[model samples]
Target: MRFLSLIWSNLKRKKLRTSLTILSIVVAFVLFGLLCSLKEAFTAGVNMAGADRLIVRHKISLIMDLPFTYGSRIERIPGVAAAVHWTWFNGIYQNEPKNFFGSFPVEPEPFLSMHPEYVVAEDQKQKWLQTRTGAVVGRTLAQRFEWEIGDRVPLTSPIWPRENEEAWEFDIVGIYDGAKKSTDTSGFFFRYDYFDEARARGEGQVGWYVVRVEDADRVAEVAQKIDDEFANSPYETKTEPEGAFAQGFVQQIGDIATMLVAILSAVFFTILLVAGNTMAQAVRERTEELGVLKAMGFTDGLVLVLVLAESCLIASVGGLIGLGLAWLATAGGSPAPSILPVFYFPVPDMLIGVAIVVALGVVTGIFPALQAMRLQIAVALRRHA
Candidate 1:
C-alpha cells in the first residue's frame, strides 16, 4: 500500500506507452471473453435443455424421414405422455437470400398441447387450430419483422416447393412467446396437414418427433424402449434427450470446442509476448530510478515485488475492462439471430479471464523482476553515472 504511489508514478512516467500496453491487454481479454461466450452459445442447448423432453429421429440422420404413423405408437409407450412431430421448412422470404429464419410444419394440436411452455392466447390458439393456412410465430420472430396478427406471411421452401415454385402464403393467426430462455422464441410454425397437402411430394414422411416423458428420471428407459420398438424396421428410430439432439447439429459442423480452445491458446500466447516486452522495456528504462530506490534503503525483495506489482496491476485493469466489454457485446438482445443464442458472459469464463490476467502478469514480470533484483547496487549506480 505504501509503495502504490511510487509504482503508479513510475507507470505514469511514460503514460502513452503504459496506456497502449493496457489497451493491448484489454483487447486480448475482450477477444477471450467473446470467444468463450461463442463456445457457450454453441453448447447452450446441451446445458440448458429440459431434462424431461426426449427427441426421436431417424437412425441414419435427421435429414432422413420417419414414418408419420410412428407418432401414435411412441405416444402409447409406458412412460411417454405425448409425442409431437415436426418437419423442417427451410424457407426464404421475398426472394431475399439474407432473410432466413426457422420455419417448421407441425401438427398443431399435438405440438402445441405437448409443449405448454410456449404461451399463446386461447383465442389465437383456437384461430390457429381452425384456419388451415394459419401460422403461429414467436414473439421475437414477429417483432423482428414487425409482423402482426392477421398479416400474411409468404415463404418459399426449396424442400417443399409448389408446382410452379411459388411462395406459400399463410395468415398469422397467433403469436407465441417462450416461457423459458431455453425455449426458442424466434420460430415460425404452421400446420403440417396444410404443408403436406400443398407440397409437391413426400406427404407421409415426418422429420422428427418431440416426446414428453411422464417421469424425468425415466427418460433413458423411455428412449431405449422407443428405439427398441422400431429396431429392424425400414426406418429404425434413434431416441435421445433434447440437448443431445440439438448438439448433434453442431457436431456435424466440426469440433468447435477444440477449435475455440486452440484459437484462445494462440491469442493468449501472443498477449504474453507483447506484455512481457512492455514490462522488460519499462524495467530497462527505469534502471537509474531503481538504483536510486536501492540507495534510498529499499530492499532487493521489495524492489522485485514493486516491479511485479506494476505489471500485475496493468494487466488486471486492462483484463477487467476487456471482460466488461465482452459481456456487453454478448449480453442478450444483440442482433445476431442467425449465429448467437440468448447468452450472457459465463461466470466460469470471467473467472478464467481473471486467472489469465494474474498468470500473464507473473509471466511478464518474472524475468524483469529477476533482472532488477540481481543488479549490484554499486554497478547500477556506476552505470547510471
Candidate 2:
C-alpha cells in the first residue's frame, strides 16, 4: 500500500511516452471489445432461438418459396405440435428505406398461437384476426415509430406493388411484447391472406415454415421427418433447428467468428510489443533509483513486485477505459438497428478483457522485473556517477 504512489510516479516519469503507450493499449482493447460484441450480436439470433422449434425452408435456397399448403403437412408429422407460415414483406415506409424492419405476411391465428412469447391482449388479437387489412407490431417497433392502435400505416413494396403502384395501407390493430428475453419485439406481422390476394406475383407460396415440436429433445427427429416427407418433391424441403437456421443466415456473409479472432489476434500481438517496450525503457531509466531502494533494504523480490505493479496499473487503466467506451457506443441503446439490432456487451466479454489486461501486464513486466531484481547496488551506483 505504501509503495502504490511510488509505482504510479515511476509510470508517470515519462509522461508523454507513458500516455501514448496507454493510448495504444486503449485502442487495441477497444477494437477487441467491439469485435467481440459484434461476433456475439451476429450469433445472438441463434442463441435466442427456441430450442423446441425448427425451421423448414426451400432445400435449394432460402429465397425460394415453398407451397403455403406445406404448413398443414408439417403439422400432421409425428412429434410436431404446431406449424405457422410467413413470407417476407420488404415494404418501404413512406418512401424511406431507413424505416426498415422485419415485415412478414403470416397466418394470424396459428402464427400468433405458436409465438405465445409475443404477449398480445385477447381483444387486440381478435381485432387483428377479424380485420382483413389489419396488422400487429412488436412493442419495440411501435415505440420506434410512435405507432398506436388504430394508426394507418402505409407501405410500398417493389416486389408486390398495388394497382397503379400506390402504397398499401394497413390498420394497426395490436401491439405485442416479448414474454421472454429471446423474443425480438422489433417487427411487423400482417394477414398472409390479404398479401396473397393483392400481391402482383408469387401467390399461394410462403417464405418458410416455423414448426414447434412436441418435445424439445425430439426436434432433430421431427426435422428429419419433415425433410423426408418433402424429399424429391418440386420444392424439396430442408429442415433445421431454429438456432442453426439463424446462424446459417449469418454464415452467408462469411465466417464472422473466425474473422474476429484473427483480427483481435493481430491487435493484441501489436499491443504486446508496444507495452513490452515501454516496460523495458521505464526499468532502464530507473536503474539508479532501483539500486538506491535495494541499498535501503528493498529485497530483489520487492523490486520485481514494484516493476510488475507499474506495468499492471498502465494496462488495467487503459483496458477499462477502452471497454467502457465500447459498451457505451454499442450497448447503451444507440438506435442503429440495421447494424447492431441485438448488440450489447456481455459480462463474459468483460471478464475476458480483464484477464487479457492482467496477462499483458505480467508478460511485459517479466524481463524488465528480472533485470531490476538482478541489479547490484555497487555497480548501479558506479554507473549513475
Candidate 3:
C-alpha cells in the first residue's frame, strides 16, 4: 500500500504515454462490452426458444408452403401436445422498409396456446378471436409504431397481396409482451382464416408449423415422427427443435459468436503489444530511480509488485470507464433499432469483461515486472539516463 504512491509517481513521469496506453485499453474493452451485447441480441431467439417446441417446415425451402391440414395431423401425432401454423406475411407498413418487421398469419387460439410467453389481457385475447380482421402486435412493434387497441393498421404484402388489390388492413386488437427479456417481442400475428380467404393463391397452405410436444425430452422423437408422416408426399416436411430453427436464421448470417470472438482476440493481441512496449519503455527510463529504491532497502518482490500494480492500475481505470460508457449506451437504447431490437449489456458479460481487464493487466505486466525484479541495483544505476 505504501508503494502505491511510488507506482503512481512512476506512471505520472510519462503522462502522455500512460494516457495513450489507458485510452487504447478503454477502446478495447468498449469493443468487448458492445460485442458481447451484439452477440446476445443476435442469438436471443435461439437462447429463449421454448424447450418443448419443435418446428415443422418444408424440406426443400422455408418459402415453400405446406398443406394447412398438416397442423391437425401434427397435433395428433404421439408425444405432440398441440400445433399452430404461421405463414410469413412479407409485409411493409405505410410503404416504408424502415417500418418493416416480422408479420405472420396464424390461428389465434392455437398460437396463444403454444406461446405461453406472450402475455396479453383476457379481453384482448377474446377480441382477437372474435374479430376476423383483428391483429396482435408485439409490445416492441406497438411502441415503434405507437399503435393502440382498435387502431386500423394497414400492412401491404407483395407476395400475398389481397384479391381486391388494396392494402391488407388489420385492426390492432391487442398488444402482447414477452414474459422474459430474451423473449421475442417483434412479431406481428394475425388471423390465418382471413389470410387464407383473402389471398389470391396458396389457399389451404401454411408457411411453417410450430409444434408443442407433450414432453420436452420427447421433442426430438416427435419431430422425427412428424417428418416421417409426410415423407414421399408432394410437400415433404423437415421437423427440428425450435432452438435449432432459430439458430438456422443466425447461421445464415455466419457464426456471429465466433466472428466477434476472433475480432476481439486480434484487437487484444495488438493492444497487448502496444501496452507491453509502453511498460518496457517506462521501466527503462526509470532504471536509476528503481536502483535508488532498492538501495533504500526495497525488496525484489516489492519492485515486481509495484511495476505490476502500475500496469493494472492503467487497465483498471480504463476498463471501468469503458464498460461504464458501454452500459450507458445500451441503457439509452439500441443504435439500430430496426436491426438490433434486443440490445443490452448483460451482467454476466460485463463480469466477463471485468475479468478480461484483470487478465490484460497481468499478462501485459508480467515481463516488465520480471525485468524490474531481477535488476541489480549497481547495474541499474550504471544504465540510468
Candidate 4:
C-alpha cells in the first residue's frame, strides 16, 4: 500500500497511453459479461428443463402437426404420469410484427400441472378455466404491454386464420411469473379447445406433447416405449427428454453456445496481446528510472510488486466499470422480448469475470515486471545513456 502512489504516478506519466490500455480492458470485460448473459438466454430452457418430463414431437419436423390424441396414449404408457399438448399460435398483437411474443394454445389444467414453475394465483387459474376465450400471460409480457386483468387483447395469425377471418380476442384472466430466475415468463397461453374449434383447418392437431414421467429414473425407458408405440403408424413420434427438446430448439438458430465460447476465446486472446504490449512498452520506457530505484535500495521484489500492482490497477478499474454496466443493462429486463426471453447474468459468470480481472492483471504484468527486476544498475543506466 505504501508504494501505491509510486505505481500510480508511473501510470500518470503517459496519461493517454494508460487511458487507451484501460479502455481496451474495459471493452473486453464488457463483452465478457454481455456475451455470457446472451448465451444463458439461449440455453436457459435446456438448463431448467424438467427432470421427469419428455417431449413428443413429429418424427420428421417440428413444423409438422401431431395428433392431439397422442397425449392420451402417452399418458397411458408405463412410467408416464400425465401428458399435455401445446400448439404454437404465432399470434401477432396490434397487427405489428415487432410486438411479437410466443403465443400458444394448450390444455389449461394439464399444462399448469405439467409446468409447476409458472406461478399463478389460484383465483386467476379458476378465472382462466371458467372463461372460454381466456388467456394467461407471463408477468414480463404483461408489463411489456401494460395489460391488466380483464383486458381484451386481439391477436391475428397468418398460420391459422379464424374461419370468420376476424381478429381473435382473448380476455386476460391471469398473469403468471417464473418459479426460478431462469424460467421463461414472456409467453402467452390460452385454451387449446377454443383454438381447435375456431381455426380454419388443422383441427385436432398439436405442435408437441409434454409428458411427465411417473418415475424420473425411467424417463428414457418410457420415452423409447412411447416412440415404439407409434412406430410404422401414420404419425410416427420422436420422444426425447425435455432438456434435449429445448436444446434442439436452440440449435435451430445455430450452435449458439459453442459459437459464443469461440467468440469469447478470440476476444480475450486479442486483449491479452494488447495489454501485454502496453505493459512491455511502459516498462521499457522506464528502464533508467527502474535502475535509479534499485540504486536507492528498493529491493528487486519490491520493484516487481510495484509494477504488477500498476497493471492490476489498470485491469481492476476498467474491468469493474465494464461489468457494472453489463449488470445494469440486464437488471431492467430483456431489451428485446421477442428475440430473447430469459435475460439474466448468473452469479457464477460474474464471479468468473472478477477472477479474470485478477488473472489479466498478473498475466499482462509478469513479463514486464520480471524484466524490470533483473535490471542491473550500471547496465540499465548505460543503456539509457
List model 3 lDDT by residue over 245-291, tens digit each.
99999999999989998999999999899988988998888888889
TM-scores, one per candidate: 0.84, 0.90, 0.93, 0.95
lDDT per residue for candidate 2 within 322-380, as digits (tens), equals 98888787655425654556566778888999899899989988999999999999988
Predicted structure 1: clash tally? 0
Question: Which scores better on TM-score, 1 or 3?
Answer: 3
Candidate 3, superposed: residue stretches over 4 Å from native: none
lDDT of each model, Cα atoms only?
0.86, 0.87, 0.89, 0.91
Which of the two, 1 or 2, has more lDDT?
Answer: 2
Better of 2 and 4 by lDDT: 4
Sort every candidate by TM-score, greatest first: 4, 3, 2, 1
Point to the candidate with the largest lDDT.
4
Compare candidates 2 and 4 on TM-score and give the better one: 4
Candidates ranked by lDDT, best first?
Answer: 4, 3, 2, 1
Candidates' RMSD to native: 3.3, 2.5, 2.0, 1.7
Evaluate model 2: give its lDDT.
Answer: 0.87
Q: What is the lDDT of residue 77 in candidate 2?
A: 93
- Between prediction 1 and prediction 4, which has the larger TM-score? 4
Model 2, stretches more than 4 Å misplaced?
Answer: 116-127, 143-146, 163-165, 176-183
